[model samples]
Target: MTDIKATVFIPTYYGEDNLDELFTALSTQKVGFEYEILVIDTSSKDRTPEIIKSWEPKFKHFRYETITKPEFSHGRVRQQAAEKARGEYVVYLTQDATPAHDRWLYEIIQPLERFPQVVGVMGKQDPRTTALPLLKEEIIRTFKQFGPDFGTTLFYEDDFIDSQQLFDLVTFYSDVNSAARKSVLLGDVPYQDIPYAEDQKFGEDLIRHGYMKAYAPRANVWHTNEIKLRDYKKRMFDEIVGVRRVGKTMDPISILFVIKQVIRAVTLGSLFILKDHQYTWKRKLYWLALNPLFVIEKWKGVRAAIAVDLDDEQTIVKQSLESNEAIAHGKQ
Candidate 1:
């Protein structure tokens, strides 16, 4: 028997239904070297662990562990998973999202092996077919507003880049699909308080550590969570608040930032109306083009996420990286 050099990380929270699909997809991963599968379950009340129990018989290298205590937050759970990892590179994934490409796992780890300076690699995030139209439209809209004309999709083929540019790609620290070395994280680099800011803060920390964050276009995944304009705005607001909380709790920032971002939003949002009018109008048009169907479904999704007991499961507003359902149904 030989040891695998890489580990695939799945941070699951009541993802039994979703895990089945992702596990099936993972089976086809290109095998250059041996690999280990680490399923980090965050103590879901759902049947997710039971699902893993059944898979255990089928997979030799498959391992599963749960965080029995619900007191912890998302970042804490992620840190727990990172601690459990024993591979050269760890692949972080949302339990619901699926890898669109088989080479996704390989492409993400390749940079670290090839370049010692590359500390992390992030993949391109595309909407899966299973994603509802409202989700699809709203996601595209969010990306557009987050970084207009940056392209509808965030995949790029660059080997080396500065931290600021990497931050720009992330649209101000949203860690949707990303990977990093296990050695860099396990010991002292404590993650932020919540699940949300961990990725952004890490990329920033790596930047501070004098390492390069690489972006891989080929390594792609589909993340699903569809919301409409109102929902998108709420998500954005949550995002802004999260960042501000991190700033206040971890390290205090000057009044200059508050003043700067407010000005940027007011100015840039209006500029979006002018030079970037096409992007803004299309988003508006998508809202209008889809009519009530788009609006209702998105509103439903937003409400679904809100209505769900957060402790029980991720907001029903879940989207898949490989969502065939959304594509077929045309609803979120």
Candidate 2:
């Protein structure tokens, strides 16, 4: 019998800033079963290795491996982690995503333990306090669609009428705070070698192949991108391009389309800011005035990304944040 009940796996790049808190939270998990914390580092130039070493003595089963930056691909690296993991259930977490409470590990892995048909489970993500107003609302709104924050929901192939319905209702999976059965990860539905959206693709494959995926709302983590204004367009470009790479089609860019989208986004965003109680009146007014510029930048990014030739890797690399970071670090 396997002594390790679960493996909490994390992939790190320049994660020195987030690793200390994350390790502290992981070390104090309120769990009855045995588990291991395994980290795969992409040769981070920061103090990530030092931080990992500092936390080694805090856990009974903690270890990490290093891979060159150039060798990292989201799906491939994660699949490698699964192969190295010794637990019956492998839980994936990004280095920057911190568990909100001590029970996070237990809560995320429970559905996998209790439900035989549930091959995978995803936890809720709450935005960090420093998150921008738009991003904060989007995070909350996105997770709320799965179910109540305190409840659990499961999705299977039989629940939907068609592939489109399934994609629309249940294909949204995230590795930021998620768990999957070890047998399934190493079997027929292993992660594909994709540049982006691998998590959602895995979810689609699981549900299509007659397995269930679950959402445990209480398994919460803090995650968000505190994007600066100058980088917002690049961020949006990466996002839409990732969606396109996953086989989703975007509307063809046109003058009328751009005009309509910007106007609609600004109007709705302005109303949200005005109605939100989290922001002070001055902040609300600031966002309202700035909403138009953000909306315009968003549409411009979306349009440019949609027009990109999927075969042209050079052009996509220029437009996306993923490649830019690698290039900045001399990894690409």
Candidate 3:
């Protein structure tokens, strides 16, 4: 079994109900070859640790470890996990997601067995049944976010700044699903400099640094969650800020670009409130009529992105706590 080495890494925090189901699905799969499981946890205040411990027997190869730094977001934390991983290949999946089929693991890892140049393979993310809207919306957001680099050139090109097809890059990447050869990721924690944007940075860096990225759609997974519209807008703003945070290290124009995007986002979101989604007579009328508030609200998300600083972790922590609680209350 040592001949074909592979490992699955699940980095988690606050994955309560979803983690249990994901592990259960993993336990039933027929992975006869030598493989290992690594779960890097950030001091979870939820039931994630207990769930992983319960599956120790079912997943005999699973190794669970925790890191307590609150400053590192999930993506950075994931890079930290990869540093400690011993497998020749690393398959990454979010706890809220589960493999869609039994052959998922096989399909994801097979590329490396056949092609030595393939440094990484990230799977397609398809929502189960009623969740297709989330997928579609995410596609739209990614298409807009990534601009022209969607599908054409293997890597983002400065020459094609307005290319619209590059949305495929986002489609190919899901924090919920991905795999990579350890050789490509070793000592690559430089991508983890922000509160988020690790996956985008990781893929971009791999391509820039001489590794090739692969998209194997057959290795699919079903994600059980979606960001609400408000949350989605906020998360994007946060990611934009994360990008700017990193960009400042490389170029200030990048930060200016983020500011431009935030301004554009405010305009785009306002238009949506006024023109898109026929939610209801009352909602449509109210939101459209009160476009100023909608614009203001979304802009707040953009500002929040600029406000986060590594040295001021507590300040960001307080805001994150408030935002999370607001979302919970809204859902309730």
By lDDT, the best candidate is: 2
Candidates in order, TM-scores: namely 0.64, 0.91, 0.68
Q: Every model's Cα RMSD, please? A: 10.2, 2.3, 7.1
Q: How much lDDT does each candidate structure score?
A: 0.58, 0.85, 0.61
Q: Model 1: per-residue lDDT, tens digit, 1-332?
A: 57667777777765776788888777778868877788877567678888877877676578887764444555776666667777777777777777886877777677778787776777656666545444554455654443333222232324454564454454333345667777877743545567345676765666656667666656667778644444453454344344433542222333465455445434543343334333445554443444344343334333433334444423322432112222333322
Model 2, global lDDT = 0.85
Question: lDDT score, residue 68, model 3?
Answer: 64
Q: How well does candidate 3 score on lDDT at residue 257?
A: 60
TM-score of 3: 0.68
Candidate 2, residue 249: how far the Cα is off, in Å: 2.5
Give candidate 3 misplaced runs (Cα > 4 Å). 1-4, 69-72, 132-136, 139-173, 187-193, 227-233, 248-332
lDDT of 2 by residue, 1-332 (tens): 64998999999988988889899889889999999999989988889999998888888999888998778888898898889999999999998899999999999998998999999999999988655666777899999999998788998876445666446568788999999998999996788777787887888889878899999999999998756676677788888887788777767778787787668657877787777777888888788777667667767777889888988988888888878888888776
What's model 1's overall lDDT? Answer: 0.58
lDDT of 3 by residue, 1-332 (tens): 35546778887766777887788778766665767788887667678788888887786577888766444475666666667667778788888789988878877887677777666676766554433232433544543443232221123334444533443353234456878877767754234544555676676666555556666666778774545545544654555555555442322234456555446545664455445443455664554444444334445655665656645755554555334643453421
Q: Provide the lDDT at 84 for model 1.
A: 76
Which stretches in model 2 have alpha-carbon errors above 4 Å? 163-166, 253-267, 274-291
Q: For model 2, where is the 10-residue window of minimal lDDT?
A: 159-168
